[model samples]
Target chain A: MRSSFVSFTLNGEEKELLIAPGQRLVDVLREQCGAMGTRNGCGQGGCGACTVHVDAVPMLSCLVLAELAEGCDILTIEGAARDRTLHALQEAFVAEAATQCGFCTAGMIMAAKALLDRDPAPQREAVVEALSGNVCRCTGYEPIIAAVLAAAAMLARLPAAAA
Target chain B: MTRLRGRGISAVNYPTGMNLGGDPSQALIHATTTGNFVVTLSSVDLGQGLRTIMTQIAAEVLGVPPESVIIDTADTDTGPHCMGTFASRATHRIGNAIIMAATEARNALLDVAGEELEVAAADLETDGDGRIAVKGVPGKSISVLDAALAAHFKYGRTISGRGIYLKPRSYPDFETGAMDPDSCQAHACTIAEVEVDTETGEVRVLKLTSAYEIGRALNPMMVEQQIVGGSWMGMSHALYETTEPYYPDRAHGPVDFAEYLMPGPADIPQYDAVILERPSASGPFGAKGIGEMTANSPIPAIANAIFDACGVRIDELPITPEKLLRALDAAAVAPRR
Candidate 1:
């Protein structure tokens, strides 16, 4: 495997790392960066547990090669919180009780966050579409939908806050 | 409450005279091979909220807050032996054992409290926050932590409880393959309305309304999520999702999010969820499971909806456009009933 040096902005901090060819971005994030919050339920990328924002757009980290994501803006679940406070979506998830084992939580939140970032006032259908990729075995979708809608409402009030 | 009893089949039918000590304290403690709490039988959560429910039951029994309880499902060796995740029995069976064990521990603490407070055990109650209160006395109270401390100091015993539960066997008859063997039964009804394209045979689910009788919803928010997730899974299974098999090894089917055709926001219709709360006779706080039921109704409901929209009945799951076209073509030649 050819080791290539890759640099990217993760969460907010810029970091440089060596990545082997064919290395999944999910593996690099989990194994290299120690971000266990981004889970890999189905390595094939059918499940959205490994979803992360690449340049502010929700993309499946499992399918993306680490080399391809170099120099791109990346955001993982670990970065969703600012300082000690959790993102609005995370708090909404807790309030709505949308998490069970919490494996899919990070990806689900990221996907919803991306949707809300792009459209601060997403309709119910838009929220559902944005999260369609992420698969959660728990909280059927009602609480998740409720959480996304609630988070959007909360985020709408805070114009100065960064999503 | 109605009790249903049946004889169980065993290769070696042990006589009823076997020395089986029946003690509430002993019967309640569920211990795995590792001797820690074995509250859930399943490894895969599938979003039924069993972990939270188990924790709540354990804390309630042990006289602690729901947050104070911790759940570990990391390894099968260290925890109790489980049957793996399926059929939504975690909350019903494991929660019961945890509650039983916790109740035993609470009673042990109350035994000490009975002496210190000079009150009968029946006169004391534990509140939602695990605070012990004397009946008919508004201000008099004791925290569960203080009770445990006092009990340890006075009796030289720790405040803890454990329980293990095995449901009575109920299997299918040999002559007729009928199984009422499930420990618990959950029922749900779903109605779907869809719009179908006559030319392409594409069917879009317009709206889905589902109502379920889940005994009781311990956490309403959690229950809603469970239903919604299950509904989406069912929708995917019914209309779009599939795992294509290749003989020697299964290739990466739906390898990426773009290729995997799950119901997007435009695809998923409006959802109207109705929760029917009926306390089960045997469950903790009258709670029954609601994890897998959402997947059960979608196939039939969507198929029924397809017939409603267009005069076609596609039987197989994931009624994709290609499959629907074939069904539509076949229907054209077949005699109209």
Candidate 2:
């Protein structure tokens, strides 16, 4: 087994850590970097509870190797807030009460954030498609979808600089 | 192109708490000198928002804002005894206990405030804004923070309360086999609309609509979320998920979420719910159990819908396409009028 020091930017902070060759990025973020918001549901890529953004693209952290994330900017749910203020998506989720049991909430919100970042004015169908990979067993996805749509509306109204 | 569509309905009722033995839950409530109340419980919040709802219950009873209540559901070793969070019991058992404990703590606070204001405890009432004032004269008031401090430093009385709610077990008569088993019952009626393709034997659940007699919805938003999640689980159990594809054999079973087929966001149907509030006599704020029952009605309703569409009764679990196709083939050969 080969292990090397991998340098990457996590939640806007530059970090370099030793990683096992087969160590999944999810383990590095959670076990090493102390990012507990990323949950491991099935370990396989099936359940998207470990979803994170790798250079603005939503990828299951459980499937991506830590080595592959070297030099890439990683964003987890902990980074979703700015200056202790909830992101528009986070606020919308709270207002809509989209979270239940909160196990998959961080992943669901991360997936939604990716969708909103790509297409700020996504329709209902698009929102559903984006979150198709994330499995929430506590399972109230309707309110979650509504919350994403609401967040999009909220974001669209924000000043260009704030958005 | 021409898929057969059918609708089926199922009505069900579930008990609020466990019926086996004495199901009990305890709460410890204490007023802090800072004017906030802390509720410590052992019941786990498995995302059903028990912490939030318990806080609401305590705040309502203590005559303070919901923010003034802090719920600490620590591990069992440190907290009091609870029957755990199952059988839809958290809200009913825990809510009742919190109300009891909050009331006791509130009385203690009022007692301290009454002495400070030179009035009897009966003459004092909380204004729901953290102030205890004389009933006739609103100006004669003292903050709860002040009273809490006085009670601790001057009176040397710890403003603390403890509560426990126990459901007495009923033993069945050996001769009659009759017993009242549960504290209360919650009811739901679900209607499922599904489409079936004869060739593929694929069932697509289009919509799941239901009306639940929830006793009372302490928080309607959380209730709706639970219903949505539970209904999806029921749908998965009906048409998608399977632990044993080779029923009697243990050769090839799904080991992960990919192998196990659960419904994703794409499969979510149009869910509509109508909440009917008929407060139960024993429930907390009239809230009966809705967590477990939310997943109950949808299962039978979906099964019945598959039968209605293709006239094939899937007695086994997860009315799979292979089974439905076999039944459809058998039905085609018989052509019963």
Top-DockQ structure, candidate number = 2
Displacement of the residue B223 alpha carbon in candidate 1, Å: 2.2
The A-chain TM-scores of all the candidates are: 0.95, 0.97
Every model's DockQ = 0.47, 0.76
Each model's C-alpha lDDT? 0.70, 0.89
True-vs-predicted CA distance for residue B68, candidate 2, Å = 2.0
Q: What digit string (tens of lDDT, one per residue) describes model 1 on residues B1-337? A: 1111111111111111011222111123332222133333334354566667667677666655666555665666555555555556667666666676677767776766666677887788877575777977846777665666676665676555656655655455899977445545567878877777777767777677778788888877677767676677777888887655324565655445546666654455677778988787777788877766677676678777776666676777778887877877888899469
Q: Per-prediction count of colliding residue pairs?
A: 22, 1
Docking class of 1: acceptable
* Candidate 2 interface RMSD after superposing interface residues: 1.4
B241-263: candidate 2 lDDT, tens digit per residue = 88667645666676666777888
Model 2, A17-132: lDDT tens digits are: 99999999999999999999999887888878899999999999989999999899999999999999899999998998888877788889999999999899999999999999
Any idea what lDDT model 1 has? 0.70
Question: With candidate 1 superimposed using the best TM-score fit, by how many Å does residue A78's alpha carbon deviate from the native?
Answer: 1.5
